[model samples]
Target: MQESWRDEVSLLPEELKEILDITAKHNRWRKYETINLIASENTMSPLATSAYMSDMMHRYAEGKPFKRYYQGTRYVDEIEVRVMKLMGELLRADYVDPRPISGTTANASVFRVLGKCGSKAVIAPVQAGAHVSHTKFGTLGALCIEHIEMPYDPDQMNIDVDHAVKLIEEVKPSFVVLGASVYLFPHPVREIADAAHSVNAKLVYDAAHVLGLITGKRWRNPLDHGADLLTASTHKTFPGPQGGIIATRDGQLYKPISRAVFPYFVSNHHLHRLPALAVTAVEMKHFGEAYADQIVRNARALAEALAAEGFKVLGEHLGYTRSHQVVLDVRKQGGGAKAAQLLEEANIIVNKNLLPYDPPDAIKDPSGLRLGVQEMTRYGMKEDNMKDIARFMRRVLIDGEDPRKIAEEVKAYRREYTKVHYCFDVNTLEDGKLYLLY
Candidate 1:
C-alpha cells in the first residue's frame, strides 16, 4: 500500500472515521460475515480487484487499442485484443466489443448502430424490473427512438407472446429487446425472435442479469434463438468486475457497432483496463459452468424453502426459477422496502422490486424483494443452506418478530457457513485485515 494513501484514508473527522472504518469493516465482513443474496452484487476475484484498485483504473489511455487518438498504447493494444478474444470465446460471439463501459452503454451502442433516427424498439416495462438502459435513460436522448413495452399476460405475469406478436406486427420496430431483470422464467427467445423476424425487426437480447446462467446453458441462449446482439454487465451473474459486454453474431454489424461506441457514444475509452476484463474472462471460462450450476440449484432450493416456510415466493406458482433469482411478494409480510429494511436489520441484504403489473405510483416501496443465489453459492451454500435461511426469515417475519434477535441468529448462521473455507486460496476476512488463508 502507498504511504500517502494510508495518511489520506486516515485523515477524516472522528465521525467520518467511524463511518469509513465500519464501511471498510463491512468490506471485510462481506469478505467474511453474513450471507450475500443481492442478485446484482458478487465478490470479484482478488486478481480482478488488483487490476482495478491496484493499477488499471488510473491508466487513461484514450481511444482504441493500437490505433489510439494519443500515443503509448503499444501494450494496451495487445491487452484489448486479448480481452476481446477471451470474451468472444466465452460468449460464443462472432465479434465482441469490450468497451461499452456498462450494460447501458452497450445497449445504447446497439441502438445507435441499428438506426439512424425514428426507429422503433420493444422492451419489458421498467416497473416489471427491466433495466433503464433499455427502457429508460438509454432511450431518453436516443436517435429519435420509439419505446414499446413487451406484452405480458396479466393473469400469468409472464410474457404475453400472443400480444407481443400482435405488437411486433403493428410497430415493425428496427430492433426488439428481449429482456427483463425480474421476470424469473426462461423467455422463449427463439419464439420472440421468430416473431420479430417476420416483421424484419432486428433482435437483441439484454441478458444483463442472466448471462452467467445462459453461459452455463442453465438459461436460454439468445444467440441460438436468433438474437443479433447480446449485452450484459460483468458483475451480476458473470460475477466479474463492474462493466459491460456487447457481442454479436454478424461480422457485418461489428464495425458499425464499434464505430457507434468510438468517437460517438464513448470517447477516449479506458484502453488499459481491458486486461482486467481479460483476466475476468479467463476466470469465468474456468469456473462459469460450476458457478452457474450452483447458482440455479441454490435459487430453486431457496424458493422451495421460502415457500414451505410460508413466504409467497412468486416462481413456484407457475414454474420455479430456472435462473439464480427468486422474487418474494412481500406485500403480505409488509411493503417491499419495509420488508427489505427489516431484512437488512437482521444482517440480510436484499432489494425492493416491483411485482408484475404493480402500479407506477407505488415507486419507492414496491411489493417485492429480490434475492439471488450467486453470493451464497460462493460461500459453499446449497440446498440444505436454504432450509436454515428460510427458517431465519420465518423467525423474524412470522414468529419471533424481533429483528434484533434475528440479527443474532443471522450472525450465528453466518459463522456456520463461512468458517475457514478457501477457493483458489481466497477466504472471507474476519478482522480488519484480509488474508489468503486462515
Candidate 2:
C-alpha cells in the first residue's frame, strides 16, 4: 500500500503532491483519527456531501431564482426554489431565503433591514452566550448600530427576564437578537419577543448552532415562540454544507431581509450549496429526531462522566445541559488554554471558551472548554461511547498520562466508528471496522 501510494503521487509536481499530502493528512486526522468536540462545528452526511459537489459550483446566480441577473440558470433556479421550500417546511416558516451564504451574513442582512446609523439593537449579553456577530465588535458594529446588552443572570445562566424587558421598553431598540455560539439552553424567546413587539421591535433568533435540534424537535423552534426572524447556518447541528438561511413568518420583514441578502450581503449566494442543503433538509425530515436525541443524550452523559472524573462541568443545577454542548470550567486544571491544548495533544479536539464570570479580555485563554457531541453522534456514538470519551480526557488531563500514548489508544477506539449514521448510506461492519457499501 505504501509503495502504491508513493508511485501514484510520483507523477504529480512536487508542490502539487505536497498540497495533496497535506490535504490527505488533515482529512485522515480530523475525520477519522480525532475526537472532535468543537461546539460550532459538525460534519455533513455522505449523501449531503456527495450532492454538494456539482457543476453549479462554477456558475453564478446573482439574484433570486427566475429573476436572475445572469443567464443559464433555469435548472439552478428550480433547485434554489425547491430548496427554499424544503427549508421552509422544515422550519415551519411561511418564508425562507437560503441565500445569505453564512449565519453572520444572514444576521447582517436582517440587521441592515432593521437598523441604521444611531439606531439601537439589543442583544443577549456575552455572558449569556451571545455570538460575536450580535455584539458591538462584529456585524452590529459594521452597520453602525448601537449594541445594547440585556442583563445576564449568572444564577440562572440566562438573560434576566424582568430587567431585559424593562430595558427593551426603555430603549425601544430597532430589533433584538437572541442565540449564541456557546449555547447550552434555550433562550427566553417568548418574553423577549413580547417586549420587542410592544416596543415595535423585531426579534431575530440566531439558530446557527442548533438548527438540527430545532428541526428534530429536540429544541424549541424560536419562530414558534415568537421570534420574527430565524437565521441559521445549514451546517452545525443542521448537518449540511456550510451556508446560511433566514426564515420568518412575517412577509413584511421577509421581503426586506431577502432584498438585503441579495443586494447588500451576498452576491452569488454559493449556488452549489443549494442541492446539498435540500438533500440534508429532506434527510432531517426523516432522521433528525433520533440523531438530535442521541446528541443531547450523549452530551448529558459526557458532562456527567467528566464531572465524575473530577472536572467542573458547568450548568450542573440546570441538569448539565439540554443542548448538544457541555461546557466545563477548566480553570482548576490550569485554565481552558492549557486544558484544551492537553486534550488536543491526546487527539481530542475542543475549544477554549469564556465562562460567564470571566471578563471579555479573557477571550484569549478563557476559563472553560466547550464540547459538542453532534459530530460524534453522527458517527453513531451513544451514551456509553461518551463515557469512553470522558475517560480519554481524564487520562490526558487529570491522570497526567502521556498524550502521545493516549492518542494511539484514541485512534484504536475511533476505528470502531467510521461510517456516518442517520443517512441513506448503507454501511457494514467487518472485523469491527465500519465500511460504506453504497
Candidate 3:
C-alpha cells in the first residue's frame, strides 16, 4: 500500500507521506466497508475536487488577490472576489470573508477578533452539544476562553436561552457562541443574541453542521435573528469544499472582521481553492436550498425509522430534526462503539459519539451514534430507506449478529438505492462512492 502511494507521488515530505499513505490504504485498500454516518462528513462535488486539484495549488498569493504582498495575483483576485460574491448571495450575509481554511479557523477568527488575553467566550460544552473546537482543548492556545455553558431543557434536550442569557449578563463575556456540533434540535439564536446584546458581547453562530440547512432555509438564520457573526465549513450539508466561511450581517462589523481574516489572522489563503469555493457557491445558488431541505427530510425520516426500531432517538416531540443529522442514544441498542464496530463489519459506516452529559467511559466508546442523511439523503434515500437501515442495525447489533450476511443485504440494497438521481452524473462511479455534480 505504501508502495502504491510512493508510486503515485514523488514529493514525500516523509511525515506527511506516511500519514497520507496510511489514510489512503485504510480508505481504499482495506476490505472494510464504509457507510459513513458522521454528519460532518459528506461527498464533495467532482468540480469542487477538481478545483482543489487545480493549478491554484502552485501559487503563493500571500495577500487578498490584487492587494497581495507578492505579485502575479491577477487571476487569484478574480477568483477570490468570485468566491466572496457567491458566498454573500448564498448566505444572504452582509459581509463575507473567504479566507479561513476550516470552520475552526472561522471560529478562531471570531474569537481572536473579540477575545483578548483575559477575554471570555461562552460556549455549550461538548457534552451539551458543542464541538471540540469549543472546549478547552480546542481553545488551549487562546488562554482564558471562559466557559459560559448554555443551559439545557431536559424535557426538550435543547438550550434554555433565558438561563444562558442570565449567565452571559452576569459574566459579561466577550463573545457568545450559539450552535453546537451535536445539537439535535433548533437553536434559539434570537434569544441568544438578545442575551449577548444585554451584556454587549458579540454573538457568533457556529453553523458548521447546519450551514447546508441554514442556506437551504430548512433551519433558522442566526444573522437574521440577531447574531452579529456566522461561522461555518463550506462542506457538511452544503456539499462544498472543506474550508471555513465567515459572514457578518452588519456593515459596521465588516472591516475589522476582514482585517481579522487578513494580516492579523489568515494570510496566504488558498487562492486555487477559491475557484472551488466559487464553483460550490454557484452550485449553492442553483441547488443549495433544495439539497438542504431534503437533508432535513432525511433526518426526520431517519429519526422516526430508528425510533421505530426501538433506539432512544432524541428530538421527536419538537418535531424531530430540522437538519440532515440525527442522534440516537444507542446505549439501549448495545453501546455506540460496539454497534459501530459491528456495523462496520456489515459494510455500514457510522461513528460513536458522546451523548449530552455522557459518562467518561461513554465518551471513550460513547453511548450515542450520530447518523446523517446528507450524502445518502442527497442520493434520494427517504423514510423507507432509513427504516431498512435501522433493520440492518438491529440484525447486526441486536439479532443475527452475523456481518457477512448483513453485508450481503447491505450490498443488495445499496445497489438499488445507489442510483438516486439527486446530483449530476449521480450514479457515475463504478465503486459506488460517487454522488455529486462538480
Candidate 4:
C-alpha cells in the first residue's frame, strides 16, 4: 500500500523528499523548540530572510562590481556597490569587500594577499580560542605559510600581551591575526598592533565573533586600533546572512585583498546575500548600540548565573565576558562532549570547546562548553532569561534531571520569546505606525 503511494510520487526523487522532510523538521525544532546557544550561529530577521531568497541566487557576476566578466548584472552591480559601501560605513573602514563566501574564505584571501608561499604568520593558539582557519592545519597551512603560536594567559583567558609582543618582535611575522572563534573578551588589538607594526608586520583582526559588537559600538574597533585589515562572517553576531567581509582602513591593502577574493578565493560570491546584508547594515546603524549593549549584559549575567550553579565558568577574574559568549568548564560533569550531548538531549544547544589547559588532542572531546547570548537576545531574551537558561543547564548537568522532561519545559519556556526585536517592525507598518522624530 505504501509502495503504491511511493510509485505515484516517483516524479520526485524519494531522497529529495526525505531531505526536505528532515530539513523542515529541523527548522521547526531549532527555530521553535530548542534553547540554542551555539556561539557561531544566529537567525536573520524576517525582512532579511525574505531578501535572501531572490533571483540573484541563480546568477553569477564574477569579478568586482562594475568589472564583471558576465553580462546582464547591472542591478547586481548596483547592489554589490551598495553592500560594500554599507559595510564600510558600518565598520568605519575605508574599504570593504563583500566577496568571500565565508569567514574562512575571507581568512584564506588575507593569507594569500599578505603572505606568499613559505611566508610566516602569528596566530592565537588553538586552546586560546583561535578559529581553525587561522591555524597551520587550516588556511595558513594550505597557503604554505608557517604559523607561530602566540603565548596565551590562562589567568586572563587571552593572549598574554607582553609575551606576544616579544614573540612578534622576535619572529617578525608577515601578519598577526587577533581574533578568535571562541572569543570571550576583547583582544589586545591596540597593543598587538603596535608590536606588529614595530616589526613591519601587518595586523589582521579576525572579528568574526565580535563584528556586531564592534559595529554596535559595544566593543573596540580594530580598524581604529591600528589593525591593517579585518575579516568577519556577517552571520555571527552581525545578524546577516552566511557570508564573509574583508574590510580595511589601509587603502594600499584593499586592492590586493580584492584581487585575492575574485580570481583566487571566490567566483560568483553569492549575490543573493548582498541585499540581505544591506538590510542588516541599516538595522545595525540604527539599533546596534542598544542591541550590542544588551548582548554583553546577557552574556555576563549568564556567566554569573552558571557560576553560582557550581559550573566552573571561565574568566571570573575578568568579569566573565565582555562579548556575547560565555565559556564553562564542564570537565567535572563528565567532560565537554558528554555534557554537551546531555544538554542537547534537553534542547539546550551548545558546542564543546577546548579550554586553555586542554591538550591538543582534546579537540575531539574538549573540557569546555561555549554559550552565546546574541541570538537569544535578538529573540527578546534578557538577563532574566539568562538566569532561566542557567537553571535549565543545571538541571541537566548538575541535578541530573531527566533530559526529555527538561526539554518539554524548555520548549514551553521558548514559546514566550518567538518574536524578533531590535529591528524595524514590519508588522507595525500594517497599522500605518508613526513616531515623533527627535
Candidate 5:
C-alpha cells in the first residue's frame, strides 16, 4: 500500500503530496515510535476502524433510528438501534442514546434538560477533575446554567463527600455531576445521589474517563448507585471510535435528553461511528473485564515506578490509583509544562494538569502531569513494561538525558507492541502500514 500510495502521489500536486507526506510521517511517529499516556485519548481496534471507514460516512440520519428525517437510512437505523441495545446491556441502562457526537455534547444535552436559565447545577470543581464542559467556562456557561462547584478534599484526591452532600442539599441544584477527567478513584456517587434526590435534583455522572472500567465491572456503575444519567466518551478507556454515549435507568429523564441530543445539539450523528461503535461494544462484551483489569494494574504499577524514580505520585494512601490514570506532581521537575514537553520530546506523550491546590490562574503551567495506561494496555503492555516506561521517563526528567537519544530507544522498544489486544482480529502492524494515529 505504501508503494502504491507513493506511485499515486507521484502524479499529485505538490500541496496534496505535502499533506499526505505529513500525515504519513505522523502515523509512523505516533503509532510506531511514541508511548501515549494522554488520559483522554485512545485508538480503536483495526476491526472497529475498518467498520468506521464504511460507506455510511457519506450519508446522514438526522433523527432517531427508524424515525429519521432522511430516507435510505434503513441499514444505519438497524445498526444504530443495535448499538444502543449493546450499550444498554453494557451500562445496565433502561435507555441508551448513542446520538450525541462527543462527551461534551452528551453533557450539554442533559444539562439542557435539567437546568433552566438562572438554575444551578453542582459539579466537581476543576481541581477535582471536572471537565470544562461542566464548568462556567464551557457548556454550562453558554447555556446559562449556574455552575456551582462541590468542594474538593485534597487528602482524599476526590470530592469532599460530606461537604458536597451538604452543599447539594443547601443549594438544591437542578442536578449534580460526578466522575472526572483526571479521575483516580471512584466518586462518592451514592452519597451525592441521595443528597441530590432529597432535594429533587438529578445526578449526572460523566464517566468520560472510566466507561471501560465501569463496563468491565472494575468500577462501580453510577446507575446502580443511584445516578440519574451517565455520559461518556467511547474513545477513552472504552477503546471504541471517537464519539459519545448517554445511558440511564431514569425513564422520566430519557426522552427529553434524547430530544436534546437530536434537534438541540447533534445532527447527522456521524453515521459512520455507529457501525464501529457497535463492533467495539461487541468486543467489550467479550473482553472488557480482562482489559480493564490490566489497565488499572498498569496504572498502579506506573505510579509506583514513577514514585520510586523520585516523582510525587498522587493518592498514595488510596493505593495510587484504582482507574487507568496516574497523576504526578511535576513541580520539582520544573512544573507541568516543562515536564510534559520534556516527556514528549523523549517520545513519551502526556498532558499538563492542574493539581488540587493549584489556583485557577495556573492553567498555563499547572503543577501536575496526567498519564493514562489504557492505550498501552490495549497494545498488550503489562505491569513490568510500565516499570520500564517509568525508567525511561526518569532518565529524561530526573537524569536530564538528551531527549533525542531517548526517542531512538523508545522507537526500538515500541516496535514489539504493534498489535491490538483484547479484540477478535488476527491483525498486526506490518512495517508502518496499519497505523491508527488518533
Candidate 6:
C-alpha cells in the first residue's frame, strides 16, 4: 500500500526545502557555532544590518548624487551624499566616492582615472600583501596597465623603502600602489609618495584591510602621509556592509574619479549599502578607537599564544602584528593547506596564504595560514579568549586530538560570545532572534 503523496511531501519543493535548510544550517554554523578567523571578513552590527535590508535594494539611482539618470532617486541621492560626507569626515579626505562595489572595483576606477591602457604602475609583491587588484592578473590587466613589482623586505614584512624608491625612480611608472592584503606593518607611504611624486607618479593606497584601524587612529592614514588617493572596502575591519570607497586629499582628482566610477566601474551603485555604510561610519566615529585597539591587542595576544603553543607565528621580531591579523608559518604542521583543513575540521576557520619564500604557483597549497582577530574582537572576544583559541589550534595540530570532539568543544566555547558589540543598538528585537547576515 503506497502512502498518499501529501503525507510524504512538504508544502515547498524538496529542492527548495533543502536549499533553505542548508542555508539556515550554514548561517547557524558560521554565525553561532564556528570560530571565524578569515582576514578579509567581518560581521555587520544589527543596526547596520537593518539598514542593509531596505527598499533601496530594489531601486536604482544611476550616476552621481543630485545628478542621477533615473527618476525616484531623491532619497537615494540624500543617502549617498550623507554616506560620502561621513566617509570623507571619517578618513579626513577632501573627497570620497562610495560607489564602487568592491575594493578591486575601487582600484579599477583609480586605474581608469590615473592612466590609460598600456600604462605602467609599480605595486607591492603579493607576498608582501599587495591585493590581487593591484596585480597584472586583476584590475591592472583589465586596464592594460603594466605591473612592476615593488621591492619587499620579508624580515620586516614590509616594503624595502630604499629599493622601492629606486625602483619607482627607475620605472617612473604612472602610479605606485601601496598596501597589502597580508599587511602586518604600515608601509612607508610618505617616503614612497615622495619618490612617486619625484618620478611624476601618483600614489594609490589600498587600505581595504586596515581601513577601520586607520579611522580609529591605530594606524597611519595614507592620505595624511602624502598618498594622492586611497581605496578601501567597507567590510573587513571597517565592519560595514560590503562596499568600496575611493578617497583623496586632492580635490582636483574628484571629477575624473567620479566619472570613472559611474560609467566605467559601476551602475546604480547598490543604493542599499549607502544607509548601512552611514550607520557604520557613525559607529566608527564613536567606537572605532576602542574597537581597533582591542582588535590589535587580540591579534598580538593570539600570535603570542600560538607561538607559545609551538606554532610558527610570523613577524615575531616585529611584535607579531600591528593590525588585526596574525600570520602563521604552517610548514612545520604539515604546510598551510593541511593545517588549514585540520583547523577547519575542528571548527576553527582560517585561510592558507603564501609565505614570502613561496613560489607563485604554490598558491594552490601555500606555506602559511592567515588568521584575523577583528571579527572575533567584534564578537566580544578579548586577549584571554585568544589564548583559548590558540590552545584549541594546538590541540588539533600538535596533540592530534580528534577534530570532531574538538568541534563540539568549539561550539560550546562559541556559545558564550554571541553578541555583537561596537555599534549602536535599539535592543528592540526578540530574544534568540538571529540578526547576523551570514
By TM-score, who's the top model here?
Answer: 5
Candidate 1: where are CA atoms >4 Å away? 1-22, 136-144, 268-273, 416-423, 426-438
- In the range 202-229, model 1's lDDT, one tens digit per residue, is 8888888988787766787788778888
**lDDT for each residue of candidate 3 in 1-438, tens digit (9 for 90 to 100):** 998886877776789879988998785522223455778877666556666776767777766657788877788888888888888887788688878888988877778777776677778767767887776667524555665566777677778767887888888988888788886777888888888898888898889988888877788878889999999997788777788989987888777777777776577776666877787777767777777777777778778877787778877787667777788777766788887888888888888888776854557788888887787775667767788888887778767568978887776667654432234452454764533323
Deviating ranges (above 4 Å) for candidate 6: 1-9, 428-438
Could you give candidate 4's per-residue lDDT for residues 1-438 as a string of tens digits? Answer: 999897877767889889989999999899999988999998888777777888888899999877889998999999889998999998888799998999999999988989988889999999889999998889999999998999999888888999999999999999999999888888999999999999999999999999999999999998999999999999988999999999998788898888889899898999899988988999899989999999999999999999998899998988999999999999899999999999999999999999889999999899999999999999999999999999999999999999999999999999998887888877656553332111
- Candidate lDDT scores, in order, read 0.76, 0.90, 0.76, 0.91, 0.92, 0.91
Stretches > 4 Å off in candidate 3: 1-33, 417-438
Output the TM-score of candidate 1: 0.89
For residue 266, model 3's alpha carbon misses the true position, in angstroms, by 2.8
Runs off by more than 4 Å, candidate 4:
1-16, 430-438
Give a tens-digit lDDT track for model 2, residues 64-155.
88999999999899999999899989889999999988999999999999999789999987756899999899999999999999988888
**Residue-wise C-alpha lDDT for candidate 6, range 305-411, written one tens digit per residue:** 99999998889988999999999998878889999999899999999999888989899899999999999999999999999999999999889999989999999
Worst 10 residues of 5 by lDDT: 429-438
Q: Please, what is the TM-score per model?
A: 0.89, 0.96, 0.87, 0.95, 0.96, 0.95
Candidate 2 is scored at a TM of 0.96
Best by lDDT: 5
Q: Which 10 residues in a row give candidate 1 its minimum summed lDDT?
A: 419-428
- The collision pairs in model 2 are none
